[model samples]
Target: MDSTKCLPRLGGDSSFELGLECREIAKTIKTRKIKYFGHIKRHTSFLKDVLEGKIEGSRIRGRQRRQWVDDIAEWTGKGIRQCTVEAQDREKLRSVSCQPLEQGRLRE
Candidate 1:
């Protein structure tokens, strides 16, 4: 049996650790989401209203689904208002978004 086949190989790194790769990918995704949200925040558009849940709709039965902003808040360990405020500053948003997964209690 080839042990290498069972592990993910990162570029130029002999160590094949799937957990590390997953963390990296998660960070990248978080960063992108933050940046995108920031962009939306700076603009006046339907998407913004949608993200903010401004659009009135009938409530669905059962547990409420998590919104994008909720995910951002959870990822940054901040409230929705704080996340929106931070998103206003590009540099701060980038820094917050790049934080390690452990720093943010990500829900499974």
Candidate 2:
């Protein structure tokens, strides 16, 4: 008997055996980022300033990279300013952060 032929019968998919659907690492990272954004916004820290402040220097001659806040805004479907306001409420932010990504958009 060929061992390869028995693989499917033994449940070759690890996710099925684990009793959980596999999730992309990108989704997990986005979720953590949203939570961390709320934490920083709620507390008084230098990191908060760095996140919200613009750098004072000459611009580099190349395509600009995406900002951290921009990622949060895109993921949440909200403006950066609005995100800052909403982040003040822990419960609201937690709910928003936990929303699952679907079809390139977040589920309410």
Candidate 3:
């Protein structure tokens, strides 16, 4: 895919560079996932439990698996508990989720 179209052109030799489209897409997906999780009733949602790591079990020994919550935390610069609290308010969650993208800090 052509990343240039997704990125802004710089006028000169500046240090700033646009983030990858894949990162942007991942961010969007993470936002949507969190929003959906927020809408679910915490009492009966298995997915919510999984997202919050409420289920207790040992993982097989190897490289640790990546988690949705971890991705969201890394992207938003917020802890999972803070994210969960903010996600309770749909509008607030949306605004917070979009902040990194707006500031062009989506790079790893």
Candidate 4:
């Protein structure tokens, strides 16, 4: 609760004077933590949530590349571990498409 809550605003009073009354007032109310999605890490978390079905995105409709992860887990419940496996699969696919003929020629 205190993680994102204000703690008496560093001490103050309703009359704009330094007093303990204001401190008590601020402590009574609770504050909520902020949730935002930024960068790949956050996307990965959202992907986890997708697998858990904690949030709804299928109703979003259309081509949901970012939200596409949600549909994949809709039928089968998946977790971050599955996401990791899928990433490895993609890497393998990528490696298969590349040509390694120049590797020996470029090396000593």
Q: How many clashing residue pairs, candidate 2?
A: 0
Comparing candidate 2 with candidate 3, which one achieves the higher TM-score?
2
- Stretches of candidate 3 off by over 4 Å are 1-27, 41-44, 53-57, 101-108
Tens digit per residue, CA lDDT, model 4, 43-68 = 45655455446544545667745543
- Which of the two, 1 or 2, has more lDDT? 2
lDDT of 1: 0.75
Candidate lDDT values, in order:
0.75, 0.77, 0.62, 0.33
Sum up the clashes in candidate 1.
0
Q: Residues 1-108, candidate 2, lDDT per residue (tens digit)?
A: 655554444455765655443345556777898999999999988998887778889989899877777778888888888888999999889888888344333232
Sorted on TM-score, best first, the list reads: 1, 2, 3, 4
Highest TM-score against the true fold, candidate? 1
**Per-residue CA lDDT of candidate 3, range 2-91, in tens?**
555567657544433343556667667766655565575234577655655544587789998766566567767778788778777878
Indicate whether candidate 1 or candidate 2 has the larger TM-score: 1
- In candidate 3, which residue pairs clash? none
> Residue 66's C-alpha lDDT in candidate 2?
70
| Clashes, model 3 | 0
Candidate 2 Cα errors over 4 Å, as ranges: 1-24, 103-108
Error of 4 at 85 (Å): 2.5
Query: What TM-score would each prediction reach against the true structure?
Result: 0.70, 0.69, 0.53, 0.18
Worst 10 residues of 3 by lDDT: 99-108
C-alpha lDDT of residue 56 in model 2 = 89
